[model samples]
Target chain A: MSESLIPAETLERVGEVLSGPVTTVIDRREAQRYAYAVGDENPIYFDEVAAQAAGYRTLVAPPTYVTHAVVQPRTAADLRTDGLYREGTRIRLLVDRVMFGGEEWDFLEPVCVGDEITATVRLAAVDQKEGRKGPFVRQVRETTFVNQFGDEVARSRMIGIAR
Target chain B: MSTDTDTAAAAPDLATLEAGQELPPMHKFPDEAQLFLYSAASHNPHRIHYDREYARFEGHDDIIVHGPLQGAWLTQFVTDWAGPAARLLGVTWQNRASGLPGEELVFSGTVTSVDAETGVVELEIAEHTSDGRLLMPATARVRLPTT
Candidate 1:
């Protein structure tokens, strides 16, 4: 087995809320753009009557969109060398490369246009494990989305694999 | 007023829906334009998704499709088939391999379980290339409208 990829400080970050609670209103135009970009023109996203017919209060955002809905804007000066924006806080890690592992989402309530949504990201877990290639680190970032009514609308867990 | 899909079709009847049933497959043909639009819509500035040369520098075959885009497709696969009335409860997907541009990606699924009492249905789903390369393995749960 190789050396530990997760340091003591990093492992201790488990269950800590890493990013601040970002609140944003679900915008109709932005949500529609996302739906159109995905090529999913589900009428419930475009037609109000159709959304109500489907038991939603109004036009609905696509499933899993709540995570994207709350992304706070960043300035161009914050661009990283890789073209991705620099995050406010960086998680320390000892790894050569990190890869996107997977994502899990739970939609508890309908996320509709014009709804105010607040999201907070937590470092759910971090651990080093033995893989076929030797040793790697598995980290999970869990984000919870709550609506204006104080109802938890959705939750997402994004897994990152580093070696 | 863009052309809409048959997403407005009737929701599945929980009474008749059973385990072992197969969902009709959905196909996607993503191009550079689609990728650009998605990047803009999602506010992602990841160069691997846009700069082909940079992507190759990063050791990718080509400007590969975004993992989250494929994930969105997985949700679309279930929701489009289950119809607009079906409430998507949860979805999970693993990123296995990269999907390149112009590849015909197919999404297929089988009903893993069904709860008649609560109108809940579970599915085992996947996305594959036309040449049979597995890109993502996924699962989802949805609540259908009762009869």
Candidate 2:
């Protein structure tokens, strides 16, 4: 994790794009699937006809539907060998022994099916501190979602806790 | 009911709930079906969310719930308590543990502070197991109708 933690003086270097811009296309089927998963039956998310009647040009996604756009079809082996963890530790940051600290999302536009959205994720901030538990790393990641038209759709700030 | 109304009406418009005051509990038991739908929805294909075998390989006991799902449940719970017209000014949550299927997750909220003139309610909300294992803890500010 120390490798990913840029020095306080070099924090500006972290903003440089470190990887490819992954493009995720949100379709109507996926939108409805996410809506049903949360048990939210809002017609704007489920029925295309209803959504159109409600003034949406096409079926739009729920407010929090962007969580599904970043997962790529990859194996744990790939993540493990590829150094998924900044250093090389098998700490289940997103699953076990970790926590979803908080999130802040700003929606600038709506997402519909066939909209090829690209997420440009960059490491925003990383800090370490000593607490009652032990030493831990708090990483803040920022991802901006833009559609094929190059219009910014949404931006998310994700806080991850790794111990 | 008359006494209850009188007390509510006389409570200085913004009654601050004490620490022990009961904030009605909301029950949510997310089944595998719901999990699948959520996995499909979020586009998060982390095997731990759906594949029991993959989850086991990754050291999880079962398909774990999504962090956002827990947060959304809490948001919905608070919204329901605050009523439909109450606009959500802001919400923040910290996930301390993972919730699995069949666990009796309860959503509860309490008024931590209030602004009488502004008619805003500061809430200390939480989602936890029936056994009191906290899953998601959050704070929210909502504007309530003064009337």
Candidate 3:
């Protein structure tokens, strides 16, 4: 196996909640925009009347809409300093190129348009593996989303490959 | 509205779907502009999505499609099959290969298993290019209406 660029000590920080929990209200316009952007034509996501008929209190957000809301937008300073990796807390690694591996999501409840959602993110796991290209670090980040009532709405685990 | 009725009509009934039933194929041709919109909406600043030259520099033939965008299409495929009343329990996907702009991707699936007592069904899903190159391999579990 190729040696990992990230130091062993740094990789030890895996499974820690890097940043604090972030909370944001699900905006109707933003939810609609995301749905349209993804080419989802589900009426429940677009029409309030259709959502009500389907037993939702209001227009429902798409199943993956939480992804767009979980991470807060980066500020000007964050952009200047960290570049585009501001979705979560930064991990000190020696490698430069990073790519998204894949994602797994568990939906417990439907997200509505006006629900205030909070996402608590943690580095779930980390490992060094010999990939086709070379030795790379695979990091799994878990984000638990809950509604204003503190009910678990969804859980997302995203994997990133760094080389 | 008529559109809502049309969508509802398109949903598959639980009684009709068997273990080997195949979902209707969904064809998607996402162009460069759609990719840009997805990047903007997702706050993804990765130049590989919008910058063709940068993407080429990164070793891709053209701007590559986002994995999450492919996930979205898969979600729609299952949900469209299950209808609005069905609950999507979970989804897992792996980005096996890269997809480029304007490539005609066909999403299709086969019912792997069905649990009558629990009203649950499992599906093996995949998206492939027109030439049969697999792009994304996925699986999903959904709960159909008991009644």
User: In lDDT terms, which candidate is top?
Assistant: 1
Where does model 3 exceed 4 Å of error?
A: A1-6, A80-83, A86-88, A92-97, A130-136, B1-9
DockQ-based class of model 2: acceptable
Against the hidden reference, what TM-scores do the models get? 0.95, 0.66, 0.89
lDDT of each: 0.88, 0.65, 0.83
TM-score of chain B of each: 0.92, 0.82, 0.91
B1-147 per-residue lDDT for model 1 (tens digits): 122232344567787788998887788989999999989999889999999999999999999998988999999888888887789999999999999988889888999999998889999999999899999999999988775
- Which residue segments of model 2 deviate by more than 4 Å? A1-13, A18-20, A23-25, A48-58, A70-102, A107-116, A147-153, B1-25, B51-61, B78-90, B110-123, B140-147
Indicate the docking level reached by candidate 3.
Answer: medium
Best by TM-score: 1
DockQ, computed on Cα atoms, for candidate 2: 0.26
DockQ of 3: 0.49
Ranking by lDDT: 1, 3, 2
Model 3 lDDT per residue over B77-134, tens place:
8888888888899998888889998788888899999888777999999999979999
Q: List, in the given order, the native-contact fraction of each candidate.
A: 0.83, 0.41, 0.66
If ranked by DockQ, best first, what sequence of candidates would result? 1, 3, 2
